[model samples]
Target: MNNTHLHLVVNHLPIIFPVVGIILLVIGIFTKTEVSKRNSYFIFILGALASIAAMATGEGAEEGVENLPGVAESLIETHEEAAELFAGLSYILGGISTVALFASFRNYIFSKIMPFTVVLFALATLFFAQKAGTTGGEIRHTEISSTGTSQIIGEDIKKESNHHDKE
Candidate 1:
């Protein structure tokens, strides 16, 4: 409905993609399957695109949430800082995925380098994802919230989750 809403929708992709990509990449490496490796690259590239979308939407989301009851500006600021790092990592990893994709398709000369690049990108993605996840959790989960400025949203999440479990 809104930028924030769309952002929430797309935000899950970054988390999902890198996880799936890592699994695929590992499987590919173990099995020595070019196809699996290529698929992993494609997923990572999509994840990068999703990260861009999430970042763009995040600005509006931040604005929307900053003034909400129980929301703390300080926590939002911290989240913003982590988000910047996440976006940068996504772009870098995405770039690597693109190069890897091209190399895979063309049977290019950089075949040797692609594996190493993928490994690097995968590691970077994992780090960024952790940072992003922690920051995002702080948005509404008070106990986990590190902004040190906002009321905890942990109860809210717990209540909501409990309610869902009942259903």
Candidate 2:
């Protein structure tokens, strides 16, 4: 119903996109199907565009939920930091995929380089996805909080804060 919700909805597509693209890419390579390769490239390009939208909405989502209970500013900051990196890579990869698609269309020099670029993009995407997932997990899992594992959220933050004050 808000930017956060919109971001969540859009964000999922990018995460799954690379996996699907990679599978298709591999299949395309094995089967020598230029059509498959082109389609897979198109999927990656779409995913990259979706990544941009997700990134745009992410800031608004952060603003909306920054003060929520069980949420920490530091945690959000950490997530944002990783998100910036992830989004940047996704954009760059998407751009490369777009160019490759154009080249493939022309029967141009892209055939030689496109495969390597796709593999690189897939690896980069996989890394970004991992970082994003970890940061997201930290949002609700106190044990994985960026500040420290022991800094619990929810009722635990209150109990621990109070206990520390008494000491």
Candidate 3:
């Protein structure tokens, strides 16, 4: 498939993975189950890997859509900036998760705290992910943008009033 198609397919993984990981990590913490926490680490690692793929395809995706009618360059730039931050954080989280996984195996003292640390970093990454996702959506789905939504609402109201006047 083309880069744009590839990007659309993989872009959600980085965003969705962290949410799943966070839930699994929280469950592990509450239940005192190492298995659940380890699974969460794996999910986070996958998310980091997916972020790399998403970033790799993003430029091509941008090129594919940039010239489309109603696509805003500013919105693409904003999405790119946000995606970079999110990907950076995802990499860091993945590295920490790798270390934490090894530490868990060896029963290292730091292992006990690493999960909590990873959770915090994952949360931060998720924040950037949300920003990136929203900006990306705004690039094509103008209905969700702040100004676009208001304009749509205004147009709908005008249409409704016109229909009533016609009746």
Candidate 4:
């Protein structure tokens, strides 16, 4: 498949994985379940790997779509910036998760606090993920764009009705 198709397929993983990880982490925290927390670390690592794929495909996808009708460069730039931040955070989270996993296994003193720390980092990553996702959506989905779809549709309807009245 083309880069755009590939990007579309893989891009959601980084976002979705962390969401699942966050939920698992919360449950782990509340129930004090080591298994749940460990699974969340694994999920975060997967998310970091997915972020690499997503970032790799993004440039090619941009080249494919940048000149398409109605696609805005500004939106692409915004999304790119946000995605960079998100990916960076994802990588850090993944590294920390790896360390946390190892520490948990060894019963390191820091292991006890790692889950809470990772939770904070994951939350920050999530914020950037939302920003990136929204900006990416705005690039193609005009309904969700900042321009406001109601105004666009209302103008179209007015023009159509006016033409009908004239005819």
What's each prediction's TM-score?
0.83, 0.85, 0.88, 0.88
Clash count per candidate? 4, 0, 0, 0
In model 2, pairs of residues that clash are none
- List where candidate 3 sits over 4 angstroms from the true fold: 148-167
Report the candidate with higher lDDT, 1 versus 3.
3
lDDT of 4 by residue, 63-93 (tens): 9999986676878998999999999999999
Better of 2 and 4 by TM-score: 4
Answer with 3 or 4, whichever has the higher lDDT: 4
Better of 2 and 4 by lDDT: 4
What is the model-wide C-alpha lDDT for candidate 1?
0.81
Pairs that clash in candidate 1: 140-153, 142-152, 142-153, 142-154
lDDT per residue as tens, model 3, 1-167: 99999999999999999999999999998998999999999999999999999999999999999888666688899999999999999999989889988888899999999889999989988989999999889888877898656655777899899999999
Better of 1 and 2 by lDDT: 1
Error of 3 at 16 (Å): 0.7
Candidate 2 structure lDDT:
0.80
On lDDT, the candidate that comes out on top is: 4
Model 2 misses residue 3 by how many Å? 1.2
Q: Candidate 2 or 3, higher lDDT? A: 3
How many Å off is the CA of 13 in candidate 4?
Answer: 0.4
Better of 1 and 2 by TM-score: 2
